[model samples]
Target: MGERIASWFAAGHRPLPWRAPDFPAWGVLVSEFMLQQTPVARVIPRLEEWLARWPTPADLAAVPPGEAVRAWDRLGYPRRALNLHAASVAITERHGGIVPSDVDELLALPGVGPYTARAVAAFAYGSRVPVVDVNVRRVLARAVRGVGEPGPARTNEEHALTEALLPADPARARLTNAGTMELGQTVCTARAPRCDSCPIADACAWRAAGYPAYTGPAAPRQKPYAGSDREVRGRILRELRANELPVPRDRIAQLWTDADQLERALRGLVADGLVEIGDGGFRLPMH
Candidate 1:
């Protein structure tokens, strides 16, 4: 399984900046952070700009949190900006300004979860660990388990399957990790899987099982972005990001008619520490 996927990865896979030969660990860490719930195309340009501006953990840590929020722009989840900034500060202070390659140490950093920690270890440090993203889970489900979708992550079960497939050689294992994720994103897609293009299609369990419909317990679908608190939050963040000066209460209210929702968004941002409530009204965190 690892060999086939590794070969498929080497034959294709887009030339992302983080995938470059000897790309810095810091760059890999940032790429993983920015890639969370965000598309690769949108993340690429922003990732480049971010790395160029603050090439290291110390460089990013030196800037105010507000600057991080401002640079985050319309990334949807602005809290990630605050979390990334906090993580940089942690990396700088605790690890002497280096992104830790050890999974446990990586997980210690703010905003670093199990997946992100494992990713940094594998991709940055060449650790022989399973890097299972949503894509990998889907691929595993259909190709090996004969299921259309992986359904709400059963971490231990999924991790065991991926770990079982890992190559003994760390380098080969790393290649498999990248390959499986690529296959999931490009070939074994959630909506329209391209079975013909998949290298493992011939042996795919789901195909052999006649492509049964997914009827088991599934992950809940995401709520629509429009008119939700998320949309309101984005609007508020957009208003704040556009202005060098702090936006006043009434000025922001003008952007959205739902006064209650507007207040809720502002309060949410402040509570999340992404926004600061001050005499100047609401603004991205300055301290």
Candidate 2:
């Protein structure tokens, strides 16, 4: 498995900015957070802008959470921005503004779950750890285990399976992680995979399994944004994010016609710390 991954790494590795030699831990952390559920192309510009503004964990920690959400743009998941902001503050206050190297320490930070913690530790600190993201999981599922894509989300079994495949050597471990991720992202894509060019195609179990189609129940699609509360919430946040002063409830009322659902969405934003109520109105964080 290690030899196969090494060959893939030699032949096809994407030139992402975060993988550069000069990339700092802060940049790596931001890239990971931004890449969550967001495509790489979309994340590139936003990541560059974000890193330019906040080059360090302390720089991000000093800003307000609302600013983080505003900078997040149309990333889909706004909570990740808030969680990242909180994690930045935690890193500043707890780890002296440096992204911690310890897996346990990284996990303790806000929004730094198992995969993220391991990724930061391995990628940023050059530690030996398996970074089992969905892409890596899917690639491993097809190439190694001979299964279809892994289930909707991470499970203990998936983590263990990936861990077992990681190279014992620390540097090789990093290469393995990067190689598997690249394979999944480029060759073993979710639909219409490019198996002919895949380096590991010779050993891939899925191909040996006659490339059986994913006949099982597909994952449920998310609700559309056309008329959902999520759309309303996005509008409310956009207005508040652009305004300095407290936006009157009337101004927010103008954004949507569904009074009841809009109200619920507004309250949800407030509850989520993406907005605050003061002076008889709502406002983005002043910072």
Candidate 3:
């Protein structure tokens, strides 16, 4: 499976900037953050601009966290900006401006979870660790377990499966990891899998089994964006990001009529350190 996937990836994988051999580890880390819950097309331009603006972890660390939030723009989840800023600061202060190669050290950084840690280790450092994400999980579910979809969340079993599939050679294992993810993302998609084009289609268990429908628990649905606290929070942040000075309370109130929702959103932003309340007005956090 790894061999076939690697071959397919070599021929067809998208030429993303971070996939380049000489791309900095910092760039890989940033790409991972931006890719979360965001499409590749949406992330690409923003990622390119972001790397050009702050080329190194230390360069981003030198600026206030607010600048990171402002630069984050309309990425949906603004807290990721804060997480990236904090991670950059950690990398600068503790790792001497270098992204850590060790998975444990990477895990210790803010917002660096198991998947991200393993990804950085394998992709950036050529570690022989399994780099499992949702895409990989889905591919494994269908191709190996003969299921239509993966489990609702990643499991220890999934990790073990991915680990077992990794090639013994570290560099080869890195290629396999990335190849598997790329295959899942581009071909073995959830809605419309291009099974005929898949490199491992002939050997796919799910295809042989007649593509069984998933009977497992459904993944949780995302809440609607309109009229939600999230919407109000985004609006508030947009106003703040657009202004150099603090936005007055009344001005913020005008963005949304539901006072309770707006207040809750403001409080949540403040608690999340994405906003600062000062002098009877609100603004993006200064630090």
Score candidate 3 by lDDT. 0.90
Indicate the TM-score of model 1: 0.98
Residues 219-275 of candidate 2 have per-residue lDDT tens digits of 567888889988999899889878878899999999999999999999998888788
Where does candidate 3 clash, by residue pair?
none
Point out where model 1 deviates above 4 Å.
none
TM-score of every candidate? 0.98, 0.94, 0.97
lDDT of 1 at 217: 92
TM-score of 3: 0.97
Candidate order by TM-score, decreasing, is: 1, 3, 2
User: For model 3, how does the per-residue alpha-carbon lDDT over 139-176 read when each residue is reduced to its tens digit?
Assistant: 99999889998868767889998888877888778788
lDDT of each: 0.90, 0.84, 0.90
Residue 219's lDDT within candidate 3 is 74
Tens digits of per-residue lDDT for model 1 on 80-130? 889999999999999999899899999899999889999999999999998
